[model samples]
Target: MTAVLPERVEVAIVGAGQAGLAASWHLVQRGVDHVVLERATAFHDWQDRRWDAFTLVTPNFQCRLPGFAYDGDDTQGFMTRAEVGAWLGRYRASFDPPLLEGVEVVGLTRAEDGFLLRTSAGELRAAQVVIATGGYHRPVVPPLGLRLPDGVVQVHSADYRNAGSLPEGAVLVVGSGQSGAQIAEDLHLAGRRVHLALGRAPRSARRYRGRDCIAWLEEMGVYDVTVQQHASGLAKRESTNHYMTGRAGGHDIDLRAFALEGMRLYGRLTDASDGVLRFAPTLAQYLDHADSVMESIKNDIDAHIARAGIQAPVEARYSPVWVPEEEPAALDLAAEGVTSVVWATGFRPDYRWVEVGVFDGTGHPTHRAGETDVPGLFFLGLPWLSTWGSGRFAGVARDAAHVAERLAARAGAPVPA
Candidate 1:
């Protein structure tokens, strides 16, 4: 029996998220013939997983795809999950990229011609390959659940949709990053007793010096910081999620706020068995660290305003979330009547699909900008690939364009003339 060969194209793009769409945009503009293979119909996998009140941390203006920019009036404001999904969907419709939906790339092998992508639909050979699956991949949930009783309800943040979906009881949200903090708030606001496990994160005031902290980051080129400037690859791989909410013009989302709202606060979740959770003694340090980061951000923003001679409003009435005492390093979830546990722990890329050995020790693609170690292979959505925003909303388009252009230049881009 002979194995069947796959259909070939100039380029094979994996994942139809923001990064993939951006790459598709540039490839089409350059007249390159390509196919964007998407595992899901909707462009955003994380967006669909977000809670009901989820919104982009970046502003609307930064909601840019490859060839299109956000044209709505809420450029400075944040966009909701539905709005972003709709926006990306619209962008997909506007382009003529040969995109196949509901097609999962099960395996990618380096072929003699280019690369062979084994997908649910069929196999495809391409001169170049672009992995634009965005940063968020498989959820990173701990195996502590195996020790717990069968009655406990546990779901990672990626699997979480809203608070209403959970059982009627106190909720325990692990991980204090953006998702964890935000979901804790969601559950708390939904009238459930919430317990938030504190994780290390750099937080900021929703508005610093009368402008959004994100605006300060934009003006200061903070988002453009590259991995080269970072201390190490590990530092570069660190999460940039801020402890702030994108709701109602954005606001601070400190563990302190959740604490003040009567949410039980615990430190890093460590071990769990028989419904008992052990935690690290780091909640106080987390609070102090969050405060320090926020202050540093404010000082930097203030310095930028003064140095740039930018007129800003004077500090008026200030409302601060009161920092509360940290919880003990142990939690009795079963006794506390906590029926639901939300592992807002975030995701890690599952590269088992890619046959290429391009991953570093940190599990990220070893590439300069978007070009990988292999000649024609590239990556677009790793954090700080080109800038701090590379793995984020702002950097996806730019990085995608860069990677697409590189692939095009290498192949003399077989765009339709």
Candidate 2:
């Protein structure tokens, strides 16, 4: 049974995921009375949504929340989905903040004093509100997906579990993001013929110069790049997903690697109609773009090593490899035995609960470093809110601290005073 929320709170945090918990820890330390509301019971997304064999793309070193950090021996290693869930469970036990689970927030309106929130449990008011719901909410699938044949099974990356769950046939994994790449690899390794639809996403090596690329990035403070301090205007936008996996303690997961593993690669999925699938014929171009991005990152790492005077052993540089599709622009899925489709496009922000004018045309909140134009209104755990690590556990503390400070100031209780 859901408990009735109090009439008012000093601060109210919605979505008790990593971001919400991090913000709650900061508020509790300052003796601020706040409540974290979560629609689900668990604290991390990996606990429920990801596949059984899923692990983090980056190493375990980046799994540091505000008051908690992974102290296991696998700092240089990637964490499996189960390991991540255990870490979050431990964090919940350690702090045990005032979190109300199974409380779905249905509506939020601006009250005269602060704000009014109508939830599944009950209605409540809050002087300050922090939306820690990270950006990945709604899956951004192309409308063309609905055009697939009725017999072809369709599932989004979030709903997929393992290769065994899929029917025995040629599977087409659409989108070349991290999930798509890893899923394709999983199916192929399971002895199933897989087809990958390529996109222009960046890729990263699992290790560089004998040291984990994640550690190298940390040493060079690459994750500390804030929106304003980024290399270019475009860099201020959200960063693309990495292409590394924890299989065999992590390895490069590029398109060429997948092809070498007996997986067929194709260009981006353009359309599907009348049992015919169309591809964009940009496979080579997409490969070149990804290769260029990887090269640039490696160059930066190399320059950083040289500047630090580290006597690290040199590693062979990556060479651009391409695999072209031999098939024509359009093909029949039934003819090729393709029976299932996995869409790994991406996600969009969902904020239908909050009835406010602060949102932009794209439904993205108009904020400067998590602070909205309205007083006592802030956001947390958003990508690029402050730095590259903003949404991840490694970088959430910085943004949480900033959000707490701003919230305190708005309530007439200045923090760090």
Candidate 3:
């Protein structure tokens, strides 16, 4: 039976993902009364949003919820999509939180006593609300996609399942972030012709100097540095994550290497019209930027190793396997036999339903470590909320704990020990 929505609550959590569930765990420990509202079943995104071949980019050890650190034998291996869903399911069962699975909070506004939430079920009042729905609310597909021929099938990265599911023929994948790069590799590995449009997103080596880049960074305290301590400050939140894959025991995602293996690479997609796509002549720049970023990371790792006097095997730097001699300015879809297009562009934040003044000009919530200017409204699960790991499983635990403590204290309840 579905849980009935409560008309009022001492505290309300607007999402039930890892971030919100972590908060619930902390609240439960402190004996704080709160209800968690989830738009769908818990951990639905982990099971549904990812493609058939999707594996975690981060290692299993980073799966650190409040009381649920990964206990599996393969601590260094990445979890498959189903494994991730099951892990989150186990976490949910461990706490049995007061969760309304189908409750969708459509609108939120300030109430006289606290905050008023207009949800799909009905109106409810929460003295303190934790918005943990995360930043990826909508998939961004450009309007130019419509200009392509009607016969061509276009799918957003969020909706893509696998190469076998797409129409037979060559596939044009536009974007080179984590999703775009990995998806292209998936298609290429499946013996499908792939045309990948590169972007400015940086890349990272999977393993370096006899250790995973993530492990090295962890030992260097890179993930623990607060957003305020970084040179970019809050602006660091806008940076695209460096791309690497944990698929098949982990490896670097080198687009140039993919090019050497018969994958067609192009610059950023500028426009599409009359069944023809135009690309900017910046393919070399994109590839060069990605390589430089990877090298910079290795440089940092070398410095850390030197400073710590750690004995690790020295690894040589990467060299480009293939480089584009001349940029491909345009491509006719019909001529190239491209039957499908995948728009792997990133998402934009959508807070139109929020009727509060705590957001900035860019529609991002303005907060100091999840505490908004609005007294009882807090935003959690945002990238770089406190650190680079704020929105990720590796870091959400700390952010959730901090938010739960603040919310409990604000409501005159005992804070978590």
Candidate number with greatest TM-score: 3
Can you give the TM-score per candidate against the true fold?
0.93, 0.95, 0.98
Which residue pairs collide, candidate 1? 31-415, 31-416, 32-415
Q: On a 0 to 100 scale, what is the lDDT of residue 347 in model 2?
A: 84
> Which runs in model 3 stand beyond 4 Å of their true positions?
415-417
List candidate 2 segments past 4 Å from native.
Answer: 231-239, 325-328, 412-417
Q: Compared with the true structure, what per-residue lDDT tens digits does model 2 show for residues 1-417?
A: 757688899899998888888888878777788899998875657766798789888788788887789968988788888888888888877788899888888988888989988999989899989988788898877898888888889888988899989888999898887888898888888899898888878888878887888788888988888777877643455556767687768988877867777787778788888888898887788787787777788898899989999888898888756466563477679998999989988788899888988888878888877889988888887888877877568788788888987776666664554
Compared with the true structure, what per-residue lDDT tens digits does model 3 show for residues 309-414? 9999989899888889899999899999999999899888888888999878888999988999888888888899998778579799999988988987887886
Q: Write the per-residue lDDT of candidate 1 for residues 66-92, one digit (tens) a residue.
A: 678896887889888888888887888
User: Which 10-residue window in model 2 sums to the lowest lDDT?
Assistant: 232-241
The Cα error of candidate 1 at residue 345, in Å, is: 1.4
Candidate 1: C-alpha lDDT = 0.80
Give the winner by TM-score: 1 or 2: 2
